[model samples]
Target chain A: MTSLLALGILLLTAFLLLVVALLTRNSTPRFREIPALTRLVRTLGLSVEDGKRLHISLGHGSLLDERGGSAFAGLAALRIITEKTSVSDMPSVASAGDPALGLLTQDTMQAGYQAAGVEELYVPTTSRVTGLTPFSYAAGAMHIASNENVSTNIMIGHFGPEAGLLADISDRDYVTLIGASDNLAGQSVLYASTQDALIGEELFATGAYLGAGTSHSASLTVQDILRWLIIITLLGGAAAKFVGVI
Target chain B: MRVLTAVIAIAVGLMVLLGYFFAEFVGIQTLLLNWAVILAGVASLVGIFNLIAVHTDKVRRAEKGGVYSALLVIALVATFVFGLILQPQHQIMQVLLNGIILPVEATLMGLLTITLLYAAIRLLRRRADVMSVFFIITAVLIFLGSATLPTGDVPVIGTLIRPWVSQIWALGGARGILIGVALGTLVTGLRVLFGIDRPYGGK
Candidate 1:
């Protein structure tokens, strides 16, 4: 015990930086434009205009795993979509492989409804568990994508290569595919299949980019600060090693 | 009410995070995590029941896809009954799990190859960006490199270039992505612990 010194320090630093960012930030943090996400919101608006359904899949990620972070980011994305769709009764459906994540997705939808003052519009069936495993999850989600009158399909979570099938479904049905995944294999697949693919850490910036609130933006700012710190540390270490300082 | 929810989240989250550093707190942290896991198992049952209810309603209403829903219910019942009677370790259970489920999963995986090809072909058509070009070129190189020649392994092309390209270039890119994902995951978890993000909805 007490051996995870690095982990403890990193966690503590992240916590402190997040607090400082939240307290000092007067306005929402501005993120560099991500075309796919920007287009995703626009496509969501179009779905509302066209009176079509929008489907979101949280993938086969569980909260008990390291991939939970991506799923949480997926929930943040659900919040963004539901918040917009709640205003106009644009039907939105959320599916997840894990029931626990499904429950969170449902809760996020409810919060969105609350934020939009449209609690009555929230439907339990809107966020449901589609499947338990990765391939099965993709298959179930693809069925919905193919059969349902979905205008847009946005998946941001912990998907594997199985996501390629869902992307194919999007393509076959002419549904707009906007996706992000934490898994490297899934990202590669998405790079090929999706119209807009958020690569790597871009998935985590969904909340900040969507302008959820200042707190969301603050979290992103903290991430950026830490990323710079890590980059500098890596460079310094390499320089020191090259000079044989040790 | 929201404040209470946030406070609870912060306390539980802090406990779990701190449990890594403090052995004395690990028991309480593990207890909470176990409770969550148990709750999740129960929630899964609820999800299954909810699915049944939804499809049952559709069948009752004779909706457009009611027949499909009815079929799904019938299949689910059949599987559940068989599993219950035979138990998971029985021959019939293995047949269903390994024989049927595994093949279906394998077929889906196979389909992904074609889908990836279709996507790669359409990639440049959709976005003619520099990255897209790089991606297509890298994919082509890797695809060609990984292929074994009929004459046997080509010296520089297969053995040297392929391994270097994959091991150095591709692995490097993959490693970078993993690092970025790790950093993102750390911050995202911290956001939840700090109560900046309220995914459970109350705060």
Candidate 2:
């Protein structure tokens, strides 16, 4: 009950903030640039222009679990990527470990193509369930990344340490890799392996950075406010503990 | 069509969310989740067919890796036939798991260590920034502390510094990241609920 109430409050706060942000959207909002996202956006354009395929590896995360958050974020990123690259000679492809995520990737890609008025060009097989298990997923994705004429590989989702294999393959192939994951070991592996690696909440900001919509930017504000609240609560609790107030 | 899809999605999502707080919604939530599970199972079948189709097309086109695709198709069909006939609990199926799947997965897992080591070396060569140096040092310290020297444990590095770094600093940082991730999840869920973002083929 207490947890429910807390969740309610957080949701309410976020909704209200989102409304405020949407209502006050006359001017362009300024945001501190994320170098990784900046590089990703530039690479998207370059890949399209160079007629090179872009491979997006949405890691093995099911929507039924907590790991689904990053998977959803990855789907959002895929939507944006598909929209941007819909007209390219070599359309972008996405791979997922979970069939549910793969299904959504197909839906998201189709929606993206529909939005771009290129629905006829959308291929359902472009977004595939590459494998069922983690290592198989990484191995399958590595094959796509290395063999598909992919100049840029963007991996965002719930990856484990097995992501290292994907990174190693991308490195060997000289493909530009931008990776992120909600898992700690995955983050560590990606950070060590990839030049541009999003850590923690940065993965969630993919939509906003890639211009998914104003709502994405608004949600980022809510995240920022909630993060600061958490930090303050942590510090206050620590202080109280230090002073034996508990 | 888009509006209808969005309505159904939001309704189902709310029912599931409310199931946590209100007992009345639990029955409906369970029903919906069961349906989702069935759908997911069907989707997996569809995905398998798609995989087969992709490989078949590769073989048909005589692509560069067509031979491997042919092998994969054969292996997939053979395994499916064996599993269907013998059942997964049968000895032959167990042999497939124990002899083939487990060992293959284990070998891949073993490769990760070498991959990570090579990545760390490359990281040092590529970016020797302050954060990179700190990360390398922290990783090294943790590894050293976890290892037992043939003689005994190291002194301060193992006893004091590693404990402080891992227990305090690393834990604190991890918690911070987790909180941020949770907030992000909440916001993303709300966005979907409110129809601001529709990943379900809704406009």
DockQ of each: 0.67, 0.72
Off by over 4 Å in 2: none
Query: What is the CAPRI rating of model 1's predicted complex?
Result: medium
**Pairs of colliding residues, candidate 1:** none
For model 1, state the Cα shift of residue A11 in Å. Answer: 4.3
Clashing pairs in 2: none
Q: Native-contact recovery for every candidate?
A: 0.69, 0.69
- Which 10 consecutive residues of model 1 chain A have the lowest summed lDDT? A1-10
lDDT of 2 by residue, A70-184 (tens): 9998989999999999999999999999988888888999988988999999877788888899998888898888888999989999999999999999999999999989999
Residues B1-203, candidate 1, lDDT per residue (tens digit)? 88888899899988887787778889999999999899999988877876787678778988767888898889888898998898989998898889989999899888888888988999999888999999998888777777878987776767787789889998988887887898788877877877877888433
Please give me the DockQ of candidate 2 compared with the native complex: 0.72
Point to the candidate with the largest DockQ. 2
The ten-residue window of minimal lDDT in model 1 chain B covers B194-203
lDDT of 2 by residue, B100-167 (tens): 88899999999999999999999978677898999999999999888899867678888998999999
How many clashing residue pairs appear in each of the predictions shown? 0, 0
